[model samples]
Target: MNKRLFLSVFFLCGLILSSNAQEALFGGQNITSPEVHEDGSVTFRLFAPEADVVQVTGDFLPSVKIETQMGPMDGPGKADLTKDDKGVWSFKSEPLPSELYGYSFIIDGFKTTDPNNPFLIRDVASVTNIFIVGNGQADLYRTQDVPHGTVTRRWYDSPGLGMDRRITIYTPPGYETSKDDYPVLYLLHGAGGDEEAWISLGRTAQILDNLIAEKKVKPMIVVMPNGNVIQDAAPGEGNKGYYKPQFMVPKTMDGTYEGAFEDIIKFVESNYQVKANKENRAIAGLSMGGYHSLHISRYYPNTFDYVGLFSAAIMAREDATGKVYSDFDQTLKTQMDNGYKLYWIAIGKTDFLYDANKEYRSKLDSMGMEYNYVESEGGHIWRNWRVYLTQFTPMLFQ
Candidate 1:
């Protein structure tokens, strides 16, 4: 081969290697970074140069459309990020409130999380990223030295997804002091999230500690689980359309794990010296986890007493029209109305589920089910859910 041809071949190989290296570094999809401004808002940026279209999705952004605000971060529309000469993609938005935000990047029709953000909470245990905006993070995680809970990672044998999976747990202090029945809060993860979401990204253990120490909330054991059906990443994931994954439910819910709920419940019950009653047992989560919380508690009503669904998709109507779970039949009605100590739901005013929440509440009114509902000012991000947990947990065991 001629020298020029040899040089060209060498360059092509280097390009391939470089491209592969980039994929490894950025996890092959989108890049995200946050800018905390002087204003109350925290501007968010996601980089996806190779991606045709990159839009930001999180609790702060609404569900109706990607280019606009749906929930709390109402202003600073959801516009596309501009590309620079470097072929590096960049999109910027206005500031967000101080809290942990759950965001994912969509590139060439695929979902990706930020590689830059230090706050990568999983979809299950600690499933969101943390940005200490001007609001609650410092007080919640920094200054507040509440009693620290025990965070443990565990594995489960699964035949449904056909693999071994990981899970994490959070046990309150003094849990070892009592073998008596105490409630357990089974926390679930969101999509593209894992067993580490709650403790790491959400900073839930610290928040719970501070809240418990101050007598603001009751001390309870928190359990985090992986919500995804498949144990590993899907094939051809880089650029895919359709949210078909939304339709699948974990087999644990269907009794595939042979005491799946109890496996966790028993694992938690045996591992930690805590309570084992309906009143002492609670379950909750966000997004996929939120749906998990709603379904698990309903499906296994005998297991948990308190159920928390944050910006969750419990109502069937929400699946069709972005509405909340409101209407219920008679047997379902009796169960919901007389279910537990607290059948709770908290969400953002600016979330796509806002109307759904309202509709669900109205239906609750019709059924005379007095569920405890709290509404905050924000979108569907972890910031809202983290703060929601901080405020919501105290109500338990009270």
Candidate 2:
């Protein structure tokens, strides 16, 4: 063979071999990085020949320290990965409880989603890979064979805020065909959450669907409204059709969110064929949303007959402002006198807001009010929130 031809052939062969070697690192044909076993143990795999080190961080593991607005918050713990001669890193986790978990790969100190897993959840500003283990609580988060509801990213006029806003709405299976009017659940999200938080992270639709299918709860419409006072919608959704400049503002500059609550109620009542009375209306929220639910209920006692606060950040009237609001006690007494179908409060024992929840419960006790209290295991995480929703929805509209 000619000398030049021989050199060209050698270079082409080397390139092909390198390509094949790269492909082999991903386990050739079998691409199951997270192989969940029958016993609920999970094995994770990654192919990073050039990486110096790799680790897995998830809720199933111990708390991994991550920076947050409130200084540094401990996220799920980290598990070191062992590398093999094939340039593949792997780790097998202990049997995790049956529930949905969010995890990410820490490749050389930087957080990244699993390249092998396509199931990812977007939370606040970051994204993480997710996996489910066994049945039980995990089954509630999964999409079952029961009737499903329709979730819509809808726009509504917010005259109070002077801008059109977006909200997530869930209409049950027969909402369109049947002429029957349904009760409405105005569900709110946490401080950093948007309208999509509940449907994506909380699994509101699945919980309601399963409960309604089992006849444990009546069919109802769930409205997830954006509670941010300034931002009209979630990130990347505004007048520009993308993230607007004011999206990251410290707080809503227009007005207080409590004052704007009526806009949402009016929109739902006017648009949907829902029972437009206090008896058929319910309001619930988590974290910051819990605070909103508390204030909204107090501000307009005649608007909601059912109120739920999950991991609520309830504050004493003095703690809320410099002094107590004059009408606060009267409003509470009036609401109790009018009679509420259900005033439920649920919180995890380890939650950061647990103490505050206790304080609020004490106040309720002093007022001689009737409310249901639920204390579960775990902290202020999505797992408890999902469980609270499952427990709360079933007790509604009875």
Candidate 3:
């Protein structure tokens, strides 16, 4: 054989041997990091023999009060894991309630996701591994054998903001196939969230799919628009490209987003086969988005017949300007007088905005306005927001 051909053969054999050795070493054992048992107990494992310490933190554990710039609030709990002789660290949680939960592993002081769990979700900039304990409400968050909805990300012109923006829309299972006109629900996200927040973190599509399948909720279109006025879309989804997301962005709570709310409505109404009437329209949101929902619903007066505010930021901002924020009491009074099918308000008992919501309720009481109010146990968290969405949707267009 030629010298060049012999050398090439030798190199190829060496490469194959190296690849096989690496695979054998790394893929020798299958690690199931999170194994959900039959009784709702969760066992988490990590194979990190070199780490000095390993811990787990998640919403499934009890909450602890943590001090933040916004004040003290309840945050996720943490627990230590035991390392076995095989260098695998593991911890089993007590039987938890039916809910979708997220967690991260702290290996030697560095926080990271479970490599074995491919299911993950991004909340603002922090990405965490997620799992669900089924059989109840969490079942709605899961994709079952029931008919599912279509989630589409589309772009529309926002002449008020002078740019094209992105939005996430969920149409019911038979929307495309049927010639029927459905009612519309304008679902908005909280601060630090974007158009993708509801579909991913809030589990909007899954909830609608399960509920509509069960005949609990009416078949309607859900429109999720970016609440932040500064960005045209979610982080890494715009012209600027791949920037880290933060909890607070510019123009989030300002009147600009509320003033331009009509743009989103127009896009949805003109493009989709929707019932374009007050009785068939609804608007609801969480946190900052709730603030927008409150303002926008009242600002338009006769637009939406159903309004919901989930853990809303009800405090007045001295910096806010424009017609949307102006004459707040009168606009709200106008909204109340115009009437609605359902004016619902929901908040967690420990939510930081609880006091603000209470004050707003007092004002409404003084004005002789009536609304359905519900208070659950928790803080300003996504778990409560997801619950609120499920409860609010069933009450719309009924």
Candidate 4:
């Protein structure tokens, strides 16, 4: 062989060797790392003793592979995750607050949760996992007398989405007591989630119970709707394209969606003995549901007076624009024509949509639209959305 060809072969061999070495480092050390404290710095470690790759997954890091300590993905955010010599794979977490967050390991594109922590929020149809941080004083969780809310499993047919879906409605203390028509707040779940989400995982009902019993919030009815326009059997698996999700906001839903949202409202109004009108009704949601509230409120301007977007999936750069504002104007127009009130937006300081919500708020400012915006401690997880609803409800229907 010629000299050049021989050198090329050698280079190829070297590359294969390097890749093999990295793969060897990544075996069975699950990608998830545990919280460690050392003076001030936090340390994280993963233990995947029988796997080929492991990388930490969370909202903080959208991408992967920041370093190459173990394998191609061994150092930091690597897919070819690495483990210690004794099947112990771990790393120190960045300085973080005592608030809750979600994380997992992507063995390929699939996600896996931590085995050590028992406290977790299950995802839609019980498919995935999210980590809940103990409220600083871990023992307080055991001793605190937190009043728990009641979650009732209910089903409603959504004419807007063209399907039948289940939802969880959380009624506070006085719901079953009297013939009072309490204000209603319609809560929407995120993409790849279902009606059981907020109740089973988000814990909206429990928070309300604790708050209302303490007189922290006014008594009201919380209506959680399944956001997807189409029905989902579970996460990652569905009817494919035969159905649509409610979160998908088009230029308009004139011919699309089959008015699934309206059906939801109608069903609730007819069935539940609750005040049903712009003044007595509100809509709010997280991620995709945030998008739903904005669009749904716009579409059903006569229906909802108060609108809340919790860590809305819409981006300032992507959603804050003329068309969006124009649609918002139309929604506000209906409310203004009818003397409606309350438009609130909230997101976590560490949330991905933090900056986006600010920009959206700025847009709302430019349009002379009145809205309430808030920033709390968290990221794009249910923990933040839960508190956001808890804080925003007391101020509603006043």
Q: Best by TM-score, which number?
A: 3
Using TM-score as the measure, name the better of candidate 1 and candidate 3.
Answer: 3
Cα lDDT tens digits, model 2, 26-140, are 4453457788998899999988889999999889987655665644544688899999998889999988899999989999999998878878877777788988885788887
Per-residue accuracy of model 3 over 279-304 as CA lDDT, tens digit each: 99999999988998998898899999
Q: In candidate 3, which residue ranges exceed 4 Å CA deviation?
A: 1-29
- Where does model 4 exceed 4 Å of error? 1-96, 105-111, 116-131, 136-147, 159-162, 177-179, 232-258, 313-328, 347-363, 375-384
Per-residue alpha-carbon lDDT of model 1 for 1-398, expressed as tens digits? 99999999999999999999988876664644766667755555654456677766665554443442223334322445566765655655466556545566666666666666756544322234545655545467653545566777777555444565567777777766655555667777654455656776678788877777877877677877766545432212212332333324444233232224555665566666666677787788876577667656655656667778888765542233211223235434656755678888898987767787787678778878778888887666666777777767877876
Instruction: Return the lDDT, model 1, position 41.
Output: 59
Give a tens-digit lDDT track for model 4, residues 1-398.
99999999999999999888866665423344455443222344556577666666664333333332212221113324457898766655555544444566665466676665444665632333343345452121221365544567666666545566666677766566568787788888776666767765666666666667667677788888655544533333344543333323342223233145777778778877788667888888887778777776766667878888988855323443433345556665666465558888888776656777887787777767788878786566665776686677778887
The global C-alpha lDDT for each of the candidates, from Candidate 1 onward, is 0.63, 0.83, 0.92, 0.62
lDDT of 4 at 244: 34
Model 2: ten consecutive residues of lowest lDDT: 317-326
Best by lDDT: 3
Local error of candidate 2 at 287, Å? 0.3
lDDT of 4: 0.62
